[model samples]
Target: MHRIRLLTLILCAALAATLLTSVTARADAHPRETGRTVSGPGTPRAEVGLDPATGTPTLAVTRQGRTVLEPSPLGIVTERADLSTGLTLTGRTDREINEHYTTAAGKDRTRSVRMHEARFRFRSTATGARLDLTVRVSRDGVAYRYTLPATSGNVLGETSAFTLPGDAAAWLGAYRKDNENLFNGYGATAAPTGEYMMQGLFRTGSGDGADYALIAESDLSGSYAAAHLTHTAGSPTYGIKLWDGTPIQTSGTGTLTTPWRAVITGDLATVTQSTFTDDLAPASRVRDTSWIKPGKALWTWLAGGRAAGQSLEMQKGYVDYAAARHWPYTVVDAGWYFDPAQWDVTDPDWQQNSWIPELVRYGRERGVGIHVWIHHRDLDTPEEREQWLPTLEKWGVKGVKIDFMDSESQATFQWYDQILAATAAHHLLVNFHGSTIPKGLQRTWPQVMSFEGVNGEEKKTNTPQHLATLPFTRNVLGSMDFTPGAFHKPDRPNAGSDAGELGLTVLYESGIQNLSGKPGSYDARPVARTFLEQLPNAWDETRLLAGAPGESAVEARRSGSRWFIGGTYAGAARTAAVPLTIGHGTWLVETVTDTPAGLVRTPHVVRGGATLSVDVVANGGFAAVACRWYAGRTDC
Candidate 1:
């Protein structure tokens, strides 16, 4: 029986995520199952106990008595919520969830894992409705969500909470204005009212060393709004708070299922690499995904200056440069439409419409695709947007960058979905700027290539610390458009080094790596040119070599047979090691390292697993590229 079960699990793991939507949407109130305790039967065990006294449920996780996650508060409640006084467990079920799926976007990959799931149904003695809390456990960590049947009051919001140890500090930054802030150290209890955005990392120390777990939401497709973390008073640790705008989201709605709130537990490395986001999300909804290609796009905004500004000639120069460098796409930013000097006035109709096609034709001749930039509210009506957007296909445009949509309301949330759907229909990829944190939307709609949710290089106030925090925070949510490549930014305030900027290119992930830097930045060095021009937009495997959340880090990412390694630092000089494991072919290695004098490049080769040492100065960088068969190959 055991062998047969193992074989069945292996076969199940080979397919994409296919399962019945368990705990189906319903309206009836579940009966109370007070004083019941259930243990998750798995390697990393999770035990949940319902307290009849307080009418609330608490969760505790352990690996052979080693506490992975301390007892934490677990439930969902809205503004009109309070069944805690009469909360009672009604039904309990223990089952196994075995599923697999292929990644549709972002770092392309596959997931095949098994886990145990426990569902606890409860009745609100006061509200007279049933609510269910469903939890999943595996080797990585635990994830759970609250399901409110229609019988309950209009479920508008959730205070879904997670309480951690007081001694432990969170790898959190400010939720800031638009979640574009850098993360740093803050005690789980010390975090002010609210500062952390999606995927908060909490690190704790026990007898041996430290443990890490990431907190965030996944599969936030339907009526759910984005979830943020806050400093709350009542807990063994910290709390998870979901932010809502005017006219509360999911309010008085039909059967409401909140996004999957997760606790990814392990070391900082395991916690960072866990596939909790894509793993919990559903498979691709679009059947035809051949047109969605993630690649590098040359952007004009970075080169837009008064001299030789956004004129047609300047755009042509950028196109020729992009084509010469082998970049796949070129972006005509906002300046192409409205005069930058006077935002209210528009360029001539011919310049806006006809010039675009002319530029597209110029680019098409040289094998470069064009992407147009548009504002969110410009083409508000269906007639305007539907008319203006599809016309791009005729001009050989590959995508559109929709900007300034700083909204999180239910209306705006749904509108985002609509824009993706519409663009996909037009066979154009999409990017959202001034946007919110991602929730696995790219995987669902691969055409929705990327978004700008980070405090990227455009801000003069951004520093190396800010970039350090991104990997664990904003980037963990999904592909972020923190346009990098400001190689000459040291002249400005709070600027990181040029070498650091190069490292950032390999660190940040996006379907369209629409970077912001001088057009001639990488032209001086053949090594720089080779690295930038040949960089793959997506990767098959990635390794987070060494990192301390918001401090210093190193990463090695692989696309096909090539490997790209980058290291970054903050405040002080540090040494990072790239653990290289090579086989199957001989390789050529090119490196760019930072020094007090300036940046330098060197070439070498290696046969097997050896740690490549990198010395990074304060706010500096280290980048290297290794590929088999690229030594004498022109295609490289």
Candidate 2:
């Protein structure tokens, strides 16, 4: 009986092996690659080595020499290593470590190996320790990795830190306003020590820079170190930071650990990528309201500037334009409320304001919703917040834009969470300006529509160089309120007039897209107008077409049957051929939007397995359409 059972098991194992082989072959036949490859479960393979002597892991990248990312045993140690690609360090001291690599394939294909070291560490007399990670990037030598020393309390202490070289600063200067320090005049200045600390920096040209900062903090006691590319000037833009998932104890009250991971790729095309995790202790805290649907998009004023009663006619015209175009919402910008100094949410002035009632009425009449702007500092007190809620609800406001968060204390962070929750209680959507980088709160609070944490069009005067850097840098954190859609040229006052502005509709991801150009601008360029009208702020699917760091990028997005493709160049002009392969259904018709020549409507016949090749000019791009099968149509 035992021999018979063994034979049966062997036969079954052979059958299973054959089935697995067949499935693997089928999957291999239809392999698909999307976006740029990174170190993940599916990453390619490469040879990695760890020095038993020094306990540092070294990666022998093909093009780049043996690159040592972190120290051996990869714990908390600061020493020099080969700084080839850059440095890699673990967030905490006691966390687990992992490594990944992509195998070399064809020519021109770049492969990389990544080592992730994580652990927990404790400081003297400090019941808990915050995670700190430092990764140094260099061109020649091996990258160095070290754990940043955590301070005992809130006060920041000066410690030896690395600063970007002068040449690097000069290289980054071209992207700044007036070639000054990027963070100069923004409330916080770069320390001579050159260590990047959590402090304010002017985002070059956004007028008010007092509210922005670069923050470094740890989420877990010794689990994750987070560097926030933050802003407080009415709106903020987040840079990149690395995060290793771990858990730690909270020091005091009103504190919850949330880990944010970001990467700022100076390379223009693949600029930034980020991930966020909520490190909340299971059932140990106050009411948590982090589960919210996230929506992002741009906005524009339909009425005149925010002064009292400038011209309702202008407001009406703007509202008319939005309605005619079927836009999602129109914003009542800063000037709508009474004087900032005298304004009080409970004051009769709030109740008597004609802007909200009139605009809401007009917007509702036209099927467009209204989002009103408010000053963040004023809402600091609970009384102010309480008064504003009922008023906004009574006014039928769909959303509120909160600006000027301006601080990085634990208190302020808590307040931000409060505002998000408070507004959600009223069913009012929220857009945060002068804020910190998104820590994936949108996933927790769906009503928290969008946030302006980027150096957007407001900095057009600085340089067009920032445009190329943003996609891979600032965009990774979360939805950005870049406020795109200004059709006017640079000559227009305060407009960052890049031809690529049109492409931003496709490049930047937002649920609430604020169309900023004047009505006349869109009217003059009907092709651009049609493009805007056709765009859906929400998308069902998004695809990164083709790109290299700091070069150019092509992207395709799908909303139902309609498809939109946008391509942008960093500095130089380039061309690309993008193939449309979004779905299986055939398109019945096609429409192309091209500038100067206006919208060109064309019809193409496509089948299930056919691909449409498109060519785009330099500093220019193409938007094509493919309608799904409806009724009797066969071509798209």
Candidate 3:
């Protein structure tokens, strides 16, 4: 028996040595140190390199034989359990990505995109576990993500640096814990250090035909925290840091693909025109999306709920106004259940909120939908969801605008998905306010009407600069219930001229256009009312005729046969050569331009192929449109 045991132990020891040797030899056989280039196949091409020699990988795009990525050392860094130091390349794959998608509701309904992609497989030198870095380059810009080979451990964090050359100008929107917070437009070097909101825009400079780009993440299935830009004061470094949060995740599957770290590239036109998010994100998860509706909604929050925005009579005033304007929805913003004067749902009087059902019934009687606002934390449990959602649906509530999520963890994502599922199951449309950036999730759940992730009129501080920055940033991902159509003059000083506000109505996109400002205030304003009459729920096409982010902006949008063009400028007044695309023929034209007296409309005539020259003043805007039909022709 002793002899047999000794032989078995010796045999086991030999087997262990052979396994270790095999792993070491396999890792060594592959090139441990590699230098390879992943170049773009599309216009304004971006080429990046992946090297295993330096575990600190740099993201450099070869442009004009010069590395577009300013500093050569900016690259990817990561953390995990076995591979605490991230990955080192041990293998490679080069390929092309050609994808097309269509959304029932979005900035544009359909998107098609292609990218040159390269996958560099790496094995941790410390642990034989493997990972892959995929770099996808297209006209929109560059994107990369780490592909983890199934793990049962938590990812501590990532410190990937993304820097720009010559210290490019940038608009850093620090993490938006709420709306009304503005982005800081600083010289690249002076950019505020730390985290940034999703879809942040950065430009080269105030030069002739200078280029700009935006950074954001796509396909967040929630295995990791959202990524944000991080830098230090007076530093030339730019990189990404995971939005640190609690509930360190500890679960996964066969393979975990992190969200795409994407950078949108090109001129303001190109950036605005880019559909990177919609095109590449996972296809819609909702199979039957025919019930999804995108339209304007009236809310009492900005109207200052309860203070002046309270009372059943006042609430019906909103419903009456919505019905009058043919708006689809009228929202009883937070405080309807209780008092806006204070925040607490536990009050016994809260249940006495008979006004909500009555209001919903009134809205229904007037052919309007009723959408209410609520907090995310309030409905965290399945029982709570089971109770509240069904009750709201029974109360004739058409939709909900859930708020104050303030989280980007995996658990939050699961809950979000659950909410969407339950809401859709209830046949209710949803508007996500105080939420994270749209990951093209609306494509998955078309019932998610709009996302209020921008610094809209909610907390004020809005300006022409901020509004212009949006078309290229936040709006790029999806609709922004920028709720922008604020035609009231008093609000214009902080936001823009009445006409600029009108322009915003066209510039911004949303599944629900939640217009701010009291309707009574603008009741005497004919021009403002006329602009509202023409507001469109969905756009057939979008054209960036002229302008850049902060300097100015001009856009031409189409809804069916009618066409609308809007222009706004910042700093010094500027001229924009706006193009027309409403087919060929003479047509009646109307112009709403910012005048000292106020927004005024002038009638004129214009034809297809003619450029509508608009001279806009600082913080001023102009909107003009030509009816699709001619005097004698009926076909528009």
Candidate 4:
């Protein structure tokens, strides 16, 4: 045993050394370019020059070799490289992007420019990786991105491409794939609207191969936004459509700076590991704020008892319940202001409703915050949106949950940026629902508290399978507002049990967590109430314990001296033993919250002096506690 322990220590040290060397080598390879004309107005044009030996292409801007954008072959397989065999690469120069001018509409004038861009197409074979890279100059700005076609035969996956930007916390956006109503559920079509971002794509299959794409876009300051429109997705879809019938599966964001870093691997563990080791650096500002106060846990009242009408009595009851249990906030979903039929931002009676002021005062007195819901369509017109901001602020609303931002056009993309900024200016928190996945936006605008771009609790009733499938695919991007903690059973018997709802509080990660059932539900479950009291919605440090896409996941989070861990399973029953390790201090066992059974009190024990392990079950998970031990431990 002693020899084995020594050997394990040596192996860990060696692995750490290798990782450091690789990171150092990468940093040394690419020194930041001193002075280059990266941004300016000119006739938009793009050209690609290939390096024959490496088979890598170099992107040139403005007919000069000023900035060399190099992309490596991502999904290369052992198959022969042919027109349609392996991943095929091609480039096109389109004049549509260069024609930019202004158009007049009556007395007002609007900018109308033909977007100039280049296209790179990647076609995958039965056994290899394929990718397409495109650079375009659009009216909004310039963009250099990539796309992976949905193939019929084998799958193609790609990774390890890098981008250089002026700053680490640059603006990034993604739209959810809008073709769900068309494809239903065959091959990556028609996923839940509120899940995964539209831009990032990840593919997996049983036929020994997978197809995927990694796209990166930068605004070049104020120059132009780039474009990379791949295959026409058959008809006019509501959101950004990338393929004919295929839908996007998974997506996320990471840092791209002087070292030029980003990597996408197959499984969840590999992806997290690569992101931490290769992509993540010492962020100038660590955004976790558990130190100031324990992050507040919220109870979302969207699909609960208030689904029908916006009743002040109903909202007051929910707030009273959350306040009784000490939960922080309660969210009043959409349909509260105008009639769902004639929903409009410019409506005079929008903020004139009686329930608005009633619920606000009721919540404030009881130490609870009220969050109002708004849709993206209502905020599309900038002038109109500005009018509503003051009203929301005057109402003393703590936050606003904006929904339905499902477009990837430059105009819609810019709209998202403006809304976040405006919300921040009002000193109000924002939660983007029915929107795209987050791309480090939380780091830039901390007030943009949470986002719902994952297939969350709403679909659990219709599609039971998605409840288990989403954590592995969509949850990795960032903090996912899954609207967890539902306390009701399915309407039908033998469909499944509703007992698994408690597991989600631990399973999902969000700065603003929503307990998704009526307040009465919490009154019935003593175990859940206890767990909610102890759980920390935000964290100081977060670690991926164990996981694989569409399988199972285990995560550990720390806020100050206390540590909490959560594990979950998608389809099948699974088990994972997680070690309790956070920093180098000694820890003591506190409590373990399990399923319907209840919490178990254990004797205090010391760890970090030794490795600790926890075991979990499938479709089910566990949340355990470990805190710093100051002196000799005793029985709890």
Predicted model with the maximum lDDT = 3
Per-residue C-alpha lDDT of model 2 across residues 1-636, encoded as one tens digit per residue: 999999999999999999998765533332234111112232221223334344233322111221111111222221221222223322222112222311111000112223322222222122233333322211111122233333322222111121221111111211221112222222222323222222222222122211111122223222333332322222222233222112222343432223322112212222222121111111112233342222322344431345423455666666777888877677777766655554554566756655577778887888777788888876888888987877888888888888887544445666876776688787787777776645445545556556676666555343344554445434543566777776654632213223455677777766566667777777876766776777775665555555532455556666666766665654433345454556676664353534345545456666544655443444444455556766677544
lDDT of 1 at 316: 88
Q: Compared to the true structure, candidate 2 yields what TM-score?
A: 0.61
Stretches off by above 4 angstroms in model 3 are: 1-35, 39-48, 51-53, 62-67, 71-88, 94-96, 205-209, 245-248, 307-310, 339-353, 489-496, 572-588, 607-609, 615-617, 629-636
lDDT-superior candidate, 3 or 4: 3
Q: Which ranges of candidate 1 are over 4 A from the true structure?
A: 1-44, 78-81, 206-208, 232-236, 244-253, 305-309, 339-352, 379-381, 491-496, 581-588, 596-598, 628-636
lDDT of 3: 0.70
Q: Which parts of model 2 are misplaced by more than 4 Å? A: 1-68, 71-298, 301-304, 307-310, 339-350, 491-499, 571-574, 579-618, 627-636
TM-score of each: 0.85, 0.61, 0.85, 0.59
Give candidate 4's error at residue 385 in angstroms: 1.1
RMSD list, candidates in order: 7.3, 12.6, 8.2, 17.3
Please say which candidate is ahead in lDDT: 1 or 4.
1
Regions of candidate 4 where Cα sits further than 4 Å from its true position: 1-49, 53-270, 273-297, 300-309, 339-350, 461-473, 491-500, 571-575, 583-586, 590-606, 609-618, 629-636
248-284 per-residue lDDT for model 1 (tens digits): 4555647777778877777666665667666777767
Give the alpha carbon lDDT tens digit for every residue of 1-636 in model 3: 999999999999999999998766544443334335555545444444435455555566544343345533433233444442445666666667777776656657667778877677767676667767787778767777877766625566554566776667887787755433566677777776666776667777456546776877887765656666777877766666666644336456567677787777776777887777665577777777776777777777766555533477888888898888888888777666555544344564543455678888888899888888878876788987986788788887888889888766677777887898899888788888777778757766778888887787654566667766777778878878877665553655334467777777777778788887678755766787767766787877787877677667777777776777777777756565666645688666677876678778876666776876665666777877667646664322
